[model samples]
Target chain A: MNAPATERFVVPIGPQHPALKEPGHFEFTVEGETVVDATVRLGYAHRGIEKGAEGRNWTQTLYLIERICGICSHIHSTAYAVGVEQLAEVEVPARAQAIREIICELERVHSHLLWLGVAAHDAGFDTLFMYTWRDRETVMDILETMSGNRVHYSANVLGGVKFDLTDESAVAILKGVEFLEERTHHYRKVVSEDAFFLQRTRGVGTMTHAEALALGVVGPTARASGVARDVRLDAPYVAYADFPARIQLLTAGDLEARFLARLDELLDSFRLIRVLVAGLPAGELTAKRMPRKLKPGEVISRVEAPRGELFYYIRSTGGEQPDRVKVRTPTLCNMGSVITQTIGHNLADVPMILVGIDPCFSCNDRAVTVRRAGDDNGRAWAWADLRRYGIDYYRRIRN
Target chain B: MDTITTQSPPRWRTMLDRLRNWSLANSPWLVHYNSGSCNGCDIEILATLTPRYDLERLGVKLQGSPRHADVLVCTGPVTRQSADRLRRIYDQMPEPKFVVAVGACSISGGAFRGCYNILGGVDEVIPVDVYVPGCAPRPEAIIHGVAVLLKKLQPDRAEEIDRLLVEAGAVVGEEEGIDEPNAELLGAR
Candidate 1:
């Protein structure tokens, strides 16, 4: 057997690692501190959601799809509903459209705050994590009050939103957003100039503007890298067509830039949310009596989920249930960039770089592994087996 | 590791045993493993630990490794590839091991009921003592469910595993009326 002399070993991070909240396996080959190569293996958390959607009826599938990712449940259900509505060719009320957009922006606020907290935790800044999470409760409280549930606020139905925002509800929501707005300004200041935080984020990891465009990354990941592309701005749908938003971008293409982009998006979301709430149209909560069965059609529903662009391709057979429901979540598109960007960074920055994508593992689980020609071992490395092998290998090396 | 020959055991041994069981119940270190979930439950589970829900106030800590965990807080259905690792994880934990299966999918395959790749709920792969059902249950619901399981653990665990199982079944009608058998009481993960 031939082997490299340097301690350039492949360190596998997860299927279940401490850094990653969701299950994802990444095998990184490192020479000392610098990462030489990286390969990500997802599907540690694949629940066959798309296949599950095929069996259930149009109505049942909406609830099922909403459960895809807890953080972005509204976006998933909204995208799916918009697709179904288009397939059915049902006219959604302006009120419903604005309501969906309202939740979408509110969700963005919660999600960005969620990302900030999680990213802070990744960098060993527990205090920052706690503060952001505590303030995030205000948004969660508003969401729960509006839709009756916290995480999976099932606000959207097929043709329109399930819940309507009353003047009182609107008042409560604006108060929450105002509180968040003031807090967001403080966070923006901290991330931009904090000495300790800047050491971990600034110039630590670089993804050039061209690399971002070449990899075809979406959401803040691409926006941070100077690609001025946002689905909301480019292809506005639902209420976005009615109430457009400012696209936030940063050209640094670094971790600090990623943080600032999300914060800027949050600020933008708060402003849009205020607009949607104030200018909320007066109409029926749902569209007029929607037909039970659709008139056979295909619709591609694209919505900006908190992470990035959530693309849902839905095909209907004119039956009750959909023929096929293919979801291409934003995390999947942004994931490739993480693999490419990690190559030149140090091992310690891996968590920061990975979290920069704000990955949702269950969304990106459809994967196939192809074995290399020379690799022959059929041993499945259970944690028990892996732990034992590690001990034995170390023992032999020492002797 | 000696069971006392005398009917009445020594005071020091009993005290130490009491301390161990109390500590175990008070600070239930959990290792959350998502066999195959949509991450609705995983994030909710994580939220349960954050400041708002403050799972730490209940003395709960989310452990990274199974061996260090007292309770296995599992989410989602048992996928074929993950079943082996799920079982392996359950095996790794030292006994009097409690498995709290969280989410509807983990409970009875929820929405992904007949999916080919899914092997149904977590119980199909490993024995689950407490079942918390929700499409993605609120963090508060999860806390209540874990409390139900921890309530059964004795001050000094006596009469081995079988008796522990009997106690788990017996205490369902207490504060949180919902138990493993009554699926009706369960909410979405």
Candidate 2:
């Protein structure tokens, strides 16, 4: 059975929804079960973070900006610190740079693990979801041992990191690494072998290389679609210059391919962390002192977050606070392609399509309300109307 | 190797079976919801399942969907817009659910307490079962919080609901505002 040729069915997936974990509205225009058009709405979680950054001093703002997104907190702080330090011409110690790299890589590990679990759940593989998260905890524990808190490590200051990795902490981290490596192997097996996962994800939500580039998709989403774009490799930031990044590229643009790409990236992060921790530099963890005032200038910083390329454009005004802090998260770019990919897919596959980008609506917050052409037919068509129409059409055709 | 049957099970039957099993074990699948916060509690919550703390041995798994998860691990102070989304997520989870407020912010807004954007704590909008107190609680503490939640999930623990209501006294009514209660006032808020 097909949708009525003259009428289009519209489905509003959120402002609140079971399939979506974050707050954002998505409206889909469907022909039968296929999504003919999709529109996303965000800003459901806007907190005036940029405005808040205006009044706070550079030091206080460091802690403030890190709270932008819990998963990407460290990178936000890193980007902010990098901007302020650049403006002040402050050189952080080599040890602190190395420490920043370690923490960033650790954050990537945890974020990817969390994403894996979420992706698995979207495909209804609850066991895989659990296993990936269980493994993710090791990375979080390592961060906690280094810094007092697990989520907001508070390790990054304007000039350098606040906490140094003691011998005990270092040993504890190495031990955790050993455990993670073993767990990752098991995850690799399960992710590959599970038939239901393969059925749900394979060839679903395919984003081709051309489409990904045109849409400005970044990070693993872009890489999964056969684009070799990684900010860490292209523009080395912090200690990224010291360690070579082994970027993982996948040719398949399917959901499974995206899942595999994230898994591969997680393994590479593990290797990078080992190198960083082993080559621990001996020096001050923070710079001697940063200038109280910044020079008036504009600087743009890009870092490869767990999701993809995270861009920060900061304009300083020779004051304690920045004049403007504009952030363009990876999800913002990746979200554009959801409509293109979800079309021609089954209704059951909608969540999989949404999750193919490892969407973090928390970071990319904006929801668009969609209005279609010709909805003024003086009739409101609910989801039930579409279902009923489909059922009746099927019965008539069979008869 | 034996090939498994590919026939789709009836939806109602499958749901009933899974529900029965889930009720018996009370296995909570957790989906970590970040509104806006420092990464402290988010990291510590992740640590709970690592080898040192290893929360998985207790049959708890972190889930991705509000639909599948029995517990929602929410970290952050509720921002104006995120409050609506958080409420939607809370509504999406299947019946007999629990929320774990795992950080000082999730429990009582922590360092960002008086900040303009923050709504203080998660419980300001939704019901919370366990509160792990720390600027960011350690992984071990997070694990402990989860264990406490698992206990509350038991079918026979109806009395715990009253305990939570009692603990969240003023806020439960209109006496206290939607701003989260402080950690010191958590047990007697």
Q: Which structure among the candidates has the greatest lDDT?
A: 1
Name model 2 segments beyond 4 Å from true.
Answer: A1-8, A366-399, B1-75, B82-103, B106-133, B137-186
TM-score, first chain, each model = 0.90, 0.89
Per-residue lDDT of model 1, residues A184-210, tens digit only: 999999999899999999996778999
Tens digits of per-residue lDDT, candidate 2, B1-189, equal 011122576777567655654563455678777666444565556556544455666667875567887778887678765787788888988765677787777777765666556677898999887787776666655665665555444435534533443343312433543334442333212
Docking model 1 quality class: acceptable
Q: CA lDDT of each candidate?
A: 0.82, 0.74
lDDT by residue for model 2 (A248-315), tens: 99998888888889888878888888898888889998899888788999888888888888888888
The CAPRI category of model 2 is incorrect
> Model 1 clash pairs?
B133-B187, B134-B187, B134-B188, B134-B189, B135-B188, B135-B189, B136-B189, B137-B189
Quote the positional error of residue A10 for candidate 2 in Å.
Answer: 3.4
Per candidate, the number of residue pairs that clash is 8, 15
